[model samples]
Target: FYSELLHIIGLVETKVGGKRLIERNSEGQRHSGTILEDTIIHLDSLDKISRLSKAFIYGETHEERLFNVALGLNITWINRILFLKLLEAQLITYHKGDKSYAFLNLNRIREYDDLNRLFFQVLAVKHEIRNDDVKKLFEKVPYLNSSLFEPTEIEHQTLFISNLKDEKTIPALSNTVLKDEQGKKRTGSLSTLAYLFEFLNAYDFSSEGSEAIQEENKTLINASVLGLIFEKINGYKDGSFFTPGMITMYMCRETLRKTVVQKFNDLKGWSCVEFDELYNKIEDKKEANEIVNSIKICDPAVGSGHFLVSALNELIAIKSDLKILQDKDGKLLKFYDVEVENDEMIVTDEEGHLFEYNPK
Candidate 1:
């Protein structure tokens, strides 16, 4: 993805007086495809990119700065896209698996312009005030009041998604889940946008823990897993990735469990060491909740924020262990048990059914 995006940035630069030299001896035959080597550019030398390079990148040379800028832009775009992918999954889950609200597919967003509008005009704006052109085009895609939908500082100084040509194809990754019709792995290239949407579509982004799986086993990609992935990918330049989720979960449980115990012991004369001990001693759920709320956590690494998410899950699981996890009504979730297993939070009933969040 980063490889293709390097060429995209260069292509975008060409609109604003940036020069591009199609490599004469390039591996890619002069086809209608997007790839990095196809369009070689001095992006850092360009005025627009230079401003961004100066503002964000700490690299010394033009080549260094150019690569960093392209990478940052590509990652930012991918994150936003992934967020929407999850959002689409959520909306579909809410509507009884209805596909009407799904906007990430090529059918709804046929080109980059549609995606651009989805970002800046449709999701970014309130539904009532959106342009009729896109509002009708994307039915039931509600206005998600999220910063992801808003244009970033980088986008303000550069081209939007609509600026990139959509008819381009890019080489598929060698290690790919995409397969060919001969019941084998696909080795050839694929249309850029088509591949992205289809790749995401193949996975099940089901937040609902209660959903049953059928014959076709699908990979479940949730927010926490996505967070781990994004953090790992973003930290590739730094040679750092997420402290494995198991370790994170264990660390959080140990730290938070001890901290909670200490706070209770200090405040009261209760010499509780285990979370289970506190369950019997605590009288008021509100007081216990306030105590838990007082605890603050910070992951100094701050890579993809997976650590913080782990801490959050740990807190919830701790509360569940103490039998104090409650709903908006102050009624305990006695019917369910929330546990952190394999670094993933699972909510199940006494009968071992996963708790599905169906607000509908």
Candidate 2:
């Protein structure tokens, strides 16, 4: 019902925007017209894609929540951040009253380098975005660029302006969302429905090759919000069941203390046989290193390697801190019986054979 309504709304919107509809065929082809051409794919399957499209287009509440929980990102927040970055790019021209902000388009901005131009254009589109709001977001730089959005060639100036100049302006592009390679504005039963349906269909089924899915007993959640709920029910929520917040904090504090102060205080004078002397009686270097350095602790309910993952992170953090200390002191630290080169831990065995512990 909503799908049909969306189709009607799209139809009405196209008429208002003065664009005609079109049809598409398989072999990945499209044609402009009022009537839609039937192909191998059916309307029922297309309806499924239509529904998913609504999730992105209408910005469904559940879908928004899903993005936040699963991806640790809010769409609006990301959009705003991009807007600010776009504003920064445009600040030089702000004094001249030349405004262009492309990030507000809610459509794709290919020329990342022309962020300022995009910002100016976006600011010019009074119906789509407001200048005041853009300015407000610019004022508050809440976050810094991470690995995902760090500036690149097209994002930086030289290539940015070059690409911006190459972009073509098409009529009715705002209402006409989809486009061809030549930037010809698309008009028709939106091809996004077909593309989206095919994508969703491909992802809907669980693959036998997916180890994570194969290991879990229950059905997977297709959506993110549901996945968070499922994750909570399945004992991966806050990881509290494995390590309660307070206990996790205490454990972290104790581990940090141990790393800094060396809790083997009482055993200062107590010298057991050297690892090599003790291991000389043992069979292999593998068994010797296991006895000497590594500690194996198991979680009671070991679902999804949660405890193990965190433990690994904590251990790596300790090692990193030690490395920093060694670098500062210009000498090896207490944890330096083994040397880590190119991420491989190399230990000298009893007979001076180098045993490599390579975690891959």
Best candidate, lDDT: 1
Model 1 C-alpha lDDT per residue in residues 1-360, reported as the tens digit of each score: 332333322222112223222212234433334422212232333455566645445367755554555556566777888888888899888887777868798788888788888888988899789988987887688888888788888767755566656777766555556667775766776677787776777678864454576434666787777876676456645444457878988899889999999998988878887867898899988888888888888766686677888899999998988888898888888889999987888889899987766764
On residues 29-83, what C-alpha lDDT tens digit does candidate 2 reach at each position?
A: 3222111212111222233223343335322564332222222211212233333
At residue 171, give the lDDT of candidate 1: 61
What is the Cα-based TM-score of model 1? 0.82
Worst ten-residue run, lDDT, model 2? 32-41
- What lDDT does the true structure give each of the candidates? 0.69, 0.31
Candidate 1 Cα errors over 4 Å, as ranges: 1-47, 50-58, 207-211
**Model 2 alpha-carbon drift over 4 Å, by segment:** 1-250, 253-292, 324-360
Cα distance off (Å), candidate 1, residue 112: 1.0
* TM-scores, one per candidate: 0.82, 0.21
By summed lDDT, which 10 consecutive residues of candidate 1 come out lowest? Answer: 13-22
